[model samples]
Target: MNVSLLANSLVGSEIIKIGNEVNEMKRKGAQISNLTIGDFDPSIYPIPDELKEAIVTAYNEHQTNYPPADGVLALRETVSGVLKSRYALEYNANEILVSGGSRPLIYATYLALIDPGDKVVYPAPSWNNNHYCVLSSANGVAVETSVENNFMPTGDQLKPHLKGATLLALCSPLNPTGTMFSAEQLLEICDLVLAENKSRSADEKPLYIMYDQIYSLLTFGKEHVNPISLRPELRDYVIYIDGISKALAATGVRVGWAFGPEVIISKMKSLLGHIGAWAPKAEQVAVAKYFRDEAQVDTFLKEFKGAVQKSLDTLYNGFQEMKKEGFNVDAVVPMGAIYLTLKIDYIGKTTPAGDLLKNSADLNFYLIHEAQTALVPFSAFGNDESVAWFRASVGGCSLEDVYAMLPKIKTALSKLK
Candidate 1:
């Protein structure tokens, strides 16, 4: 039986593969500290009490029905107000499109803006931009970023690719790296975008930006920056993706929003409507009430940040201590998000059984089986196979779990001949 070409050609998620491996080990009673998935263990980090209650109330009131394709008018208005208050972004309610989660909004952005063969530029070792490009049949242009810039691409690196690209996908408080764009760095990129769009005539497809700021509120000691916020002139060409998934520890709530040009937003609404991807009406109603209370939002963020920061700090400090002890490990400072950019650079070393470790994937499996810890290597995020860097997400583990895992990691590394 022949499937659609896209279905046949699609590679399975590397993250899921690693997750399944972890699950199998755990099922066999191997106490593995699984850190591959970028999701919170709700038991360790639950959604806010107020928001949860509101959700229950909405459901009890029989708010379960098909929501408007663009989201309920009140929810869109709440999102608009939240943006205006926090980041000074001032899109109207109609300019915003609500969906099940950030994934659908991102997919809709790709579908709405990109025609087949259109070029989509994004930094490698980021998120799933490559897969999105394949789904949309767009030309994926991967910009190689380096650790010197916190693994973020600069304007100079992106300049050559921007000439004919349709979308420049970017994210701040970036996933995998747990790093963010400094205001100055992002402003420079915004300036480049402004210039590129200015050069295009009315008839040409203008260069647009898909700024995914889902992890913006998770930054630690760093301010989140966006293109339009820095260069207001570039406002017309930027689409912003955000939601409560990270900030409020509400991933399963299935509420996300994207705001951009009215034309693009309208098209995305129609597309999502046909796909039946709107956020549940009860969840939408709950969020609308929850978002309007500024004091509660502040309180939730303060407590949530404290918990997340502790987990990140523990993993980051553990790896740093291993480095100081002359182990073959290193880690970047955890600036934002619930991930620590870690390096288990033991490639080419021999295991105790005389098997030579081959690549980052090999190291990843060694950590899973030997150390009883799991992590997603940077190579999984569109990097070359040789990059030994990996992302150790802290959201799924406890501080006590981190304390127990470090010794195991050290012992495992010592056994590598």
Candidate 2:
């Protein structure tokens, strides 16, 4: 059967592919420590009691109708306050657009800004910007970042690509790597972007930034920085993606927002409205009321981040121990988010079963079968399969699970020669 080229050419998420394989093994009674998906195991990281109760109360009050096309107004208002209080961002409700989750907001950002063949530049191993570019029919540029920069793209690395680009997709406490940009690093990039915009003609679409800070609130000790915060003049050119999904362990609740210039935001709101991608009315109402209490939000973050950090630290230290023991493995210090950047450079080795580990994927699967451990290779995040670095997401795993998997991974690597 024939299909639209876009539909036929669309690639599925690699993380979901690996996660499905692990889940299937688990269903077959395999004892696998699944670390593939960037989602919380609600059993270990439950949503705040106050927020959950608010959700129930909203539902009981019959707030089940379809939400406003942009989002519930009250939720937008609350999100506005959050911006002012948390990040010193002063976007009003009119400038905010809410959707079911950050995914739609991100997609909407692409659709609103990118014309066909327009260039979209993002750092490789960052996240789904490549796929989004495909979906939007834009020319995608994946700037390869180095491990020396903790996999975060530096201004010098991204400067050359900014010319003639329509959008620059960026993230901090970045997905897949759990690394962040220092203020100086982001400041440099911000200056480059400002200069790029200045170089563009007025009729030309200025280079816009789709800044995905979904993991902003989950940072361990590092402060989350934004392009506008560093360069307020860039306010009109930056759209921020954030929500309660990571911060409140409420991924299932489906509430995310994008704030930017009113004109751009209005277009995105119209796009989402046509798609009918609003968050549930009840969840929006619940979040509006629940998030208004700054004290409660801070209290929950303190405990939630503590648990997430403990798991990240455990995995980082475990991999460092293996490196000290002469295993072909290493890990970056946990900076933020629930991921630990890992180096499992055993791609050319042979498994005990005589299978040649040809690439990161092969090495990952070998560990899944031989050591009952699972991780996402950088290939899944737009890197080549030969890249030995992998992302270990600890959101779904407990500290005990992380502790137990280390020795198994070491044993599995030891058997590979």
Q: In terms of lDDT, which candidate is strongest?
A: 2
| Residue-level lDDT tens digits of model 1 in 309-399 | 8888988888899999999788888888888898888989989988888988888899899999999998889998688899999889888
Error of 1 at 115 (Å): 0.8
lDDT of 1 at 300: 88
Residue 4 C-alpha lDDT in model 2: 95
Q: List TM-score per model, in order.
A: 0.98, 0.99
Could you give me the TM-score of model 2 versus the true structure?
0.99
Stretches of candidate 1 exceeding 4 Å from the true structure = none
Worst 10-residue lDDT window, candidate 2: 13-22
lDDT of 2 by residue, 1-417 (tens): 399999987999888878888989999999999999899999999999999999999999999988888899999999999899989988999999999989999999999999999999999988888889899999999999988999999999999899999999999989989999999999999999999999999999999999999999888888999988899999989999998899899999999999999999999999999999999999999999999899999999999999999999988988888999998889988888889999999999998788899999999999898889999999988899999999999999899999999899988899988
Residue 335 displacement in candidate 1 (angstroms): 1.6
